[model samples]
Target: MGRHSPAPAPSAAASAAAAAAASSASTPPPRGGRAPRDADADSPSAAELRGLLEDGDGGAAPGGGRELSYLQAVNFAGGLLLPLRLPSAHAIHKRPSAAYLEAGTLLGEEAGRLLKLAGPLFIEGITNIGAQLVATTTVSRLGAGPLALSALVLAQTQLNFGYSIVCGIAAAMETCAGQAFGARHYALLGLILQCAMALCLLFAVPTAALWASGAMAPLLVRLGQLPDVAAAAGSLLQLMWPVLPLLVVSETTGQYLLAQGVAAPASVAGLTSLACAVPAYWWLVGRLGWLRGAPAAQVSLQAIAAVVVVAWRSARDARVARTEPHRATWRGWSFEALRGLPTYARYAVPAAAMLCAEWWIWEAVVFLAGLLPSRAEVQLGALGFVMQVSIATWTLSYSIGTGAATRIANALGAGHASNARRIFVLACCLLAVANSAVAATLWCLRHRLSAALTPDPEIGAEVRRILPAAILGVVGDGQVAVLGGLLRAAGRQSTGALIHFCTYWLFGLPAGVLLGFVFEWGALGLWMGVASATALQAVALHAWVALGLDWQREVRRSAATVGALLGSTGATPTPAAAPARSFAIAGLEEDGLTEEEEDGDEEGGGGGAGAGAGSALTSPAGAGGGSGLTSPLLGGRG
Candidate 1:
């Protein structure tokens, strides 16, 4: 009766218009601006992210304020809201006390992750240093005079450059493998590992020729070395020819293993080989070309140990070897791997440059010390002693950064941008804390350091004079070194390389020359230059990461980078061959097995995370994209 009296029934068109108005009214507008486009809305602010995570469903109320189940929420909320950029610890703590507490706990998780990643690396690093120490001490026992010692240092510097090149190239495997695991591109991880090894073998040829022909020594002579010293250096380098390929193989295999998540074995291999180095040195010290053979044997032992461990570990894990028929990417040795060389060079070249720039700056300083008065041998020997000691301790902080990079890369590949930021923050904080403790310990021992390194009072005195500043420089470099790892993880190797070029090459080296020589400040002056460069570099990297790093963009870029390599390496399976994200190729599914299967394949085969287990192979990119990491200077820290 009321309806008949109110008015004639509304027309269909009027009813439709009224219904539209009611629907629009049901959903409120955002408090400020219009809703962002899909791409823009994909990465939301922290508060918006909180909304998406806090509810029982752990999802946002899309359509302004409507909650839905997880599946429907995607349509309602227009996909997950990810916080990409990690401003800094200061900014995160400044938000509120509650957030600060949460941030602190998150930071702890970050630290824990970094430790898990870096602990093996740290042990590996120490083992490596121990090997070097043993070799050097053995050489000293052979009664090489200061001239021979000087020659050895120069040879070591040149050989280190070659090592960097090979390690640099192998590092591409880290990026591709990590992303492949994350994107569920398991076959691609194997292909990348193989391709990288092939490239290293090829590159070693030219490196061998250069070392054998004495080309590396002329540069030392030009740098003001005595002619006799240069010749001795050339002889030492010539003896090291057998080691280049060995080093490349070891590094490539280890990197491959680590990306797959088998970290403990790599550490074990490193330690076992390190322990054997002394015996190798003793056995070979009396042989012809013994100067070269000792180190060759030592590194060869290490390389063989790493590769063998990976093989044995993979065999032990049944799930990892379920499908051995498809192990080879192309059935044999193929240069198709060479297709990825240029792409790798983009990352490796910069990384090599960065490490070389930092390393050579110091080496160059050592040579300049020769230009000083009549104490050239004493000064050069003293400088070498300091550098070796510094290297032994410097790796502590670098391991932290390396772990951070690995975790960040794995997170990005898994499409978790927040986890990546958490890793970045944790890395920075861990480096600060770790380096602080290391710096303090080193500083406290400054007086005894020189006496321990060299026997000569004059040389010891020179090292003593410079030890304080040199240790301090270690702290500063530690900060920059780890941040450099972050850039590598983010696939911004060029940025890190550029910073190194500017700070170490252009500014730091030149300043070191002017100060140490022209100003007569000596070794102390050189370290001061390094300190200055480290400060600038740390500031630059920190600013870039905190203010300019667009992690969402990096996520896309990383995916593209890894995808390009997978395609080039011929690892992508055909559409009809299997499901896109299926674990068929790595043998995750085989022989009528039920859905339940052992996790050996998922942990898979590799070095860094317990022979390749990080749950990295989670989901396919789904026509989407990610990045992973193998550090340029990180592993190839010559």
Candidate 2:
């Protein structure tokens, strides 16, 4: 291989001209004076990428293979389970030396952006989980015996699934919001979020009725829960009504803020409220009664914090709108926004299914573990303890995953397909790094951490016994958590959902039962089976994505998705040919040639919120993450 001189990088002007040239060549002009919607079918970036891959610049040892090898996936899995010692999927392995330099630079940029977003996400997850820990501990102290403790644990575990389901429904906003923000179609971001909020609230009515009214555990009772445990748990759940709607609100709103790369206030609010809830737990439960509305206040604060952050950002955005004419706010969108609900649901339903199905797989393990004969009681306790620890560590992965999806969406929206691909691999690297640390730490402190998670020495000992399985399981959990998000960004939510169903529901669960009950390995065996399934799931997903997924195609798909969403409700700008074909239409204002020209009326000011009255929003350094009624997400577990 003679090292002839490297190809010089194209300038900004040359890049734009190449893109315009490629767009013209790839797609034809629309008919009858219509605007072009698919003009960028083969964008300049995409065309260049195709050529690069052909020359074997696809990160496979420069001239080796174009795609990520099976070996890379194995290394990635190993890295996650084992940490820095193993290699993770990386673009550097695919490109030539000059390309390698560019790939490495992009990897760092993506990593930094990912950490920026994931940091708050982890904080939110911690605080949210911490709040639940506080509430659970308080309930366990009720002096109502081990039965009371058991009931609350069971009740919460069930509620966690419900919470995940609703948030799953809201996850649609991540894709819509991420793409819209990236393409600078700022108004669509607000509209998509509003639609998500409305949709989630509709789902929440039944959820609130069940959780707030204390009906969740009763549903479990009818399914075969012990009457006493069900009754006690239902009573605990009954006091949680105030948190239901707030949960959906905080989640949907946070999704909106994160897409715009704003995270600090919500993070601060969630972490602060959760931190406060710890002390509040002692005072509220000790004096105000058990399962009382005291902890709900923290949940409420978290929800309020989420709203406050959005509002704050909205207002700042509004002010910017007043000055920056390029920030195009759509005028008179109530009718359009209202009509888009069904359109939004089209995306949201599957998005929700993907997230919920995976989360419930964990819940299913708990339910099945209860079938064990004499050891069912302590076994459930041991399982729940380890599962929560795994879930808690998953916060980091979830945050990173969310950031990965958002950043991938943004790059794709901007028509940077190559960057999107680079970032995706980098995200996997980051995920492997984070999960490796989790595996290493859990492995190191099994004795101490296990004892700390429970009061009963026997249960603690059981936790230690199964700690290795939990450590291994989280390696996969963390991988899928991020991969799942990227899949959504790639317009493959259904595929991700299907993969998860097969992995956890069809395969993992069956393996667990076979190993646990049939093989008599008990809880440890069940966990080992599940852990194996997680690894398989991650490997399978990595393999499928590496071989089949195309970043350039995904970029085009994202554009079509947002364009179609906009057109469905007559929200597409007049003379939409350029927008339909061009990734960044170069112009959005009606009369002005550029975005800096202000609209005649202030009513059209804040473009990010669409036709709704402008809400204040701004980008700030975020401080944290959150999940369920007792979730460990945004403020505290709402």
Candidate 3:
């Protein structure tokens, strides 16, 4: 699509004339100009005015309403698009020259909204990593030796691999459910949730089987791990075997709630699970001194979180049914969910690939650390500590990103293109500030953090030595986390997967191998390479968001995606009795019409509520409908 500059600001004289024209149109025209009744008849009705605004067309309305004068149409369109543009001098002066104050107020409001959404998610993420951190710390306190730490790291790596797969699969729900909820397709949200859970369970079975099998030990041994370390890791894997399916349940259900902006249950569940597991870890690992206690505690943690989240969801569903039935998203399980599986997988597979591609690279880095010719145990332990710190930081960024994704997807689903872009920009700013603070704090306490995480002086020293690379990685990770969310919101997971493969596997790993093995820089070199790759990935992803994203196109696609899912299941929205496109556009505020006003207009026009509002904007016959206009601010056709 060709780009168009923003519409020029109207002159004072033009504004006056437009206002006068509008006033004249409302009242009777001059006696010699036209008959009062004829002028009234010639003027567009409320429905036609709505059509003209929504269609972004400057000509006559679709149903042959009288042609609007250029000044009148421009003024009308300007008023509709005004909220999207920066405040103009004249517009601001009309409100007592409070432009700067208003802008600051708006910025504060948007920031507060984002933080409120991200706060619970951040707490949940911290609690998620708490189990691993506590286990690692417990092992260190018991003086379990580098062998134990190495083994724990390897086992956790495998578990993370499986978890990432399930997470990627579940990520599709963030888009589908978020959009469905925003579109007010409450029943569709339930079906999407079920479909995602089913897919995650289907994938979890083999992953759990792999962890349960004896093959992991030999595989690790072949990958250059020492015999004892490989065996120990395999044992831990067996103890943690049940976490995969439990994770499927937890992750899917958590996504379901998050999509609907219900995060308190997950946060509470995470805190409760962590609270219960810490003492279990203390008693089993620190007190009784069982090496196996760590993985066992992890198993308990996952189980508790899964049970709590599921129970909370059920209770929430029941309460909603009792009080607000229309708001409830849970419809009991049915074959409709089964029918949506293929549709879910279309986004799920690529999402899985995107996560796994990046996730496995860290596992590869750990394996490479094991291959060091000297002090392999110390290197492995150090790398494990660093990985834990990195994961903790990543969870924070990921939480913020997930929150942003929910907001962005909701905006797009509701045809609020300007709102989605605004959210993206706000999220980026928030992440940058957050990541910078985290990096500064981490840098300041690197030595202390290293010493506290590991009892061994050698491992601690190595961790301290390589700490800067991990800090750099955290900065890059913050960027990619939110950018990845943007991709997911736009349903571009396939593109994300490709970017991950190219950046990490094709470039990062090879560079790390060369730097560590060939150049003899060891673990630090490997981390440096990975950190550089992360930076590159962030750059590429950011470029895409800035240059390639088309918010209006995303809005259209969201409608189509939700519509297709509904069609596939032979279900229609109950609250939204209008056509699907009308329902999608119902949330848009660009037409300067309140819901009641639009409803009245539609009803008066002999159409269902919202029909007049959406039909003229989304229908092919409307100007700038299926074939979009060449406006830079508004994206092109789908």
The prediction achieving the highest TM-score against the true structure is: 3
**Model 2: residues with Cα > 4 Å off, grouped in runs:** 1-106, 211-218, 293-304, 328-333, 454-457, 572-638
Looking at model 1, which ten-residue stretch has the lowest summed lDDT?
585-594
Segments in model 3 whose C-alpha atoms lie over 4 Å from true places: 1-96, 139-150, 213-215, 218-224, 284-295, 447-461, 574-638
4-93: candidate 2 lDDT, tens digit per residue: 223234333334444655665566555743323222222234454444345342232421333222112222232122111112224324
lDDT of 1: 0.58
Every model's TM-score? 0.73, 0.73, 0.76
**Tens-digit lDDT track of model 3 for 296-412:** 778888899999999978987788778867657898888878788887888899999988998889878987898987788788778878987988899889888887887677656
Error of 3 at 210 (Å): 3.8
Each model's lDDT: 0.58, 0.60, 0.68
RMSD of 1: 10.9
Instruction: Output the better candidate (2/3) by TM-score.
Output: 3
TM-score (C-alpha) between model 2 and the true structure: 0.73
Q: Predictions ranked by lDDT, top down?
A: 3, 2, 1
Steric clash pairs (candidate 3): none
